[model samples]
Target: MTFTAARVIGALMMAGLGWFVSDLVRPLMPESTIFGWFNHVNLGLGFLIGWAMLGPKAGGGLMISLANGLTAAFALATVGLFTQAINEMLRLSTRKMYPNPLRALEDIFRILADYGSVLLHPTVIGPLIIGSVVIAIIVEIANSLWR
Candidate 1:
């Protein structure tokens, strides 16, 4: 893939976003042993999303950049949450919690729905929107400076 200042900055910003999101969700998680790689997964996913989505739109106007930034943020949140849900579903399935594969799959959605509501809280969404705006501004500036 092509390397650019925008990509580097975007990736770093989103990586931080992932870390922050993980921290926000920590208190919400039920008291249980968390998977060792949970935070790492979110970091890596956020980096990739930023590189692919936010980075490419860096040179755009403020509104366009904000639009893309918001889209990227939404994608990061949705995909990260979905990954966590799948992990939970797999954990349950391994313990023989589900009667069949279809049931296990359905649990993924149920888990997502449960966490989805929590994500809607003002505390969570406010930071997310603010972060996206900051990222968009910084990335746009980087694009102008570099190219």
Candidate 2:
């Protein structure tokens, strides 16, 4: 497939995968799991799914980042889009600061986006993170099993 086709397909696939995982998770925990440390799974896996499927040869990172941002749009027309935008922006900016300041900022944004829920809700910021990861891992295991 061409670069454009691959990118679109990847983004769509990841969006479906993300939605599926998030929906599966919606019932497992209370509505409070918003801290977001583990929320990166959506962003990470979504990006990887897109990169692996639709990304072009050279400018792969940019395509993945853009696809990730688009996934946010597909996710829903809500506050999360803004957060995802910021996350993608921070991630792009910090590409050079791996393992340092850049990464730290990216992590903070990811956490905030996941749990920026309410002003003072005692959020399970941790559960969402942990739960999401566990669930994503299960999905991955299932994918492997099927493959």
Candidate 3:
């Protein structure tokens, strides 16, 4: 809510990261129908986490800010993963893929595990690690320059 320059920069940077990461993972997705709103969801989540989490820690200190940036990036990924898994679970339930509600609930975790394994690929993690560092440095620079 402070709406500082660092916040704006952080939000936009993370949003870009979101879009890029989504694109990277797109081909790995099992179903095409679920991708319609995927990018948008990631964008919003990234922006929110950046603005609220990373932005506030920008001026705190170099090490602290860097740690926070990495944490925020992981948070974004975790939330996005959960969001997509739940969406997929709901879709599957609607299709009656599970014989019972309990089985449907179990499938959510199964889907999460499956996607979690995919996320472990170097292709997905490498950029995220690199981007977090870059984003942290950029936001810290914006904070110092503006304030």
Candidate 4:
């Protein structure tokens, strides 16, 4: 398959897998469980697997793998940010705090800021960095082998 086609399929498969895994684990785990962090790493893994599937002939190397991992991480973060924004907006609206779109947008920014602060904490950053590196290495190896 073409590289673009592979990437599309990989993204869809990864999204489905991520949704499935999140659903399966959510009910079984406590709110404080480390497994909560897995959602962020899922996107990186998906990118790695997708890129690796394209084989060495695709001309991607370590740099590309790292870039893809970063993209995945950012994508996951964006999704989380939007989800948080929607939930926060609903809660605020019910509390009569969001009477206008401007207020709602303000709440979204606040929510994003809160998440940004939390992301700086070691517990979150550590896993994200490690997971991205591991994903890059694995994808690099796979690409080399396929060459």
Best by lDDT: 3
Show where candidate 1 strays beyond 4 Å: 33-35
lDDT of 3 at 63: 87
Write down the TM-score for model 3. Answer: 0.92
Q: On residues 28-75, what C-alpha lDDT tens digit does candidate 1 reach at each position?
A: 767785756887898898898878888887877888888887898799
lDDT of each: 0.84, 0.44, 0.85, 0.53
lDDT of 4 by residue, 9-122 (tens): 445554444444344434444475444345655545544454444223223766776676565545554655566556657767878886687888778888777655665555
TM-score of each: 0.94, 0.29, 0.92, 0.55
| Candidate 2 per-residue C-alpha lDDT over 79-141 given as tens digits, one digit per residue, 9 for 90 to 100 | 444555466556556565456676666666564554345312233333333333333333333
Candidate 4, poorest ten consecutive residues by summed lDDT = 50-59
Q: Per-residue lDDT tens digits of candidate 3, residues 55-91?
A: 8888887888778877977898799889989988998
User: TM-score of predicted model 4?
Assistant: 0.55
Q: What CA root-mean-square deviation does each model show from the true structure?
A: 1.3, 13.3, 1.5, 6.6
Q: How many residue pairs clash per model?
A: 0, 4, 0, 0
Between prediction 3 and prediction 4, the one with superior TM-score is 3
Q: Candidate 4: deviation at residue 22, Å?
A: 9.3
